[model samples]
Target: MDARRGWLRFIGRRLNPLTLAAARRGSAPFTIVRHRGRRSGTIYETPIIVARRGPDFAAELTYGQSVQWYRNIRAAGGRCELARGDEGWQIESVESLPVAEGLAAYGPPRSWVLRLLRRHEFLLLRVEGSGGDASD
Candidate 1:
């Protein structure tokens, strides 16, 4: 692993539990992306920064492209559950976009240090449900 990713994994292991708890309480921007592990088959609830745009949601890939959650979602064929703003969504299509386009979804980086620290790639999810009922 790269130095930055190594450091991020080290910190994520310690901080993610707290973040997950806060997200489960329905925090803004902080949403939950739940997917199954690729090998272990364990369900994981990952906290991520998400922005709802129309019938879609954009999620930040802050920890770079190799994060387990990202891989799991991809491995599972772009299917996952999303909980955001006190609502649940079934995501169907997940597309990885370039930094230029993805940055628009995230608004702006909070700080130069953070901008430099995290990856800019993003996953744009197409929400599959209407009327609070998910089709798949």
Candidate 2:
């Protein structure tokens, strides 16, 4: 597990810059997630894949729930900003979803791939003005 984490860290450092650049250019499947660090309060922009689910958004927890971004988001009261394509949205709330429900939102291909990869953890992000239910 340590080796895998090391490898991922090495790769992420190299790939994140490029991914961030592409994501800013309105690229498909990539969104720029802007979050503030829980302790340092430093703002961070991370590139991730987000899928639309009704007026909300869904994302696979590819690196699990312990990732810094996820922690930061939670620490910030589940509020963040997501930039996708030429559009941007202020995420009002975020909640963990049951695997089955999350998978259903993803539909085919992505859901299948995620299932195959054993990525069962997912999050639902409700846009601020989307009128989506933000309650637990």
Candidate 3:
């Protein structure tokens, strides 16, 4: 694995459980992404930092775009489950957004220094549930 991906694996594997727990309890800046594995078909739950962007949700590709969850989301035809608090929303569209536009939608970072080290790729996940649970 690449350096950043390695680091993310090291930390995320151990800490994501707690993060997912906190996110499920309605913690700020944390949300749970539920996706199916592309090849294995096993379901996985990953915790991500999501920001509201218009009618969609924005998540930074901090460890680059090669992460399994990112790829799985795309390979699954942009369909996934997003959990915030006690509710889970279905997503239909998962596309990359330009860094500047994503940053604008996500708002100014608390640390500009950290901002400089981030990747340009960001995913904009469009919620599919409108009046019902499966309509986008």
Q: Taking the tens digit of each residue's C-alpha lDDT, what string does model 1 give over 34-69?
A: 999999999999888777656787776766668888
Model 1 residue 67 distance off true place after TM-score fit, in angstroms: 0.3
If scored against the real structure, what TM-score would every candidate get? 0.77, 0.91, 0.84
- For model 1, the stretches where C-alpha displacement exceeds 4 angstroms are 1-6, 108-119, 129-136
In order, what lDDT does every prediction score?
0.75, 0.88, 0.80
Candidate 2: clashing pairs of residues: none
Where does model 3 exceed 4 Å of error? Answer: 1-5, 110-114, 129-136
Best by lDDT: 2
Instruction: Report the Cα lDDT for candidate 3.
Output: 0.80
Winning candidate number (TM-score): 2
Encode model 2's per-residue lDDT on 1-136: one tens digit a residue. Answer: 6997887797579988888888889977789999999999999999988888888899888888888899999999999999966889999989988898789888899899989999889899999988877463
What is the overall TM-score of model 3 with all chains considered together?
A: 0.84
> Any idea how many clashes model 1 has?
0
At residue 109, give the lDDT of candidate 2: 90
Q: lDDT tens string, model 3, 63-121? A: 78788899999899999999989878899878777677677767766225336776577
- Candidate 2 wrong stretches, greater than 4 Å: 134-136
RMSD of each: 4.7, 1.8, 3.8
lDDT of 2: 0.88
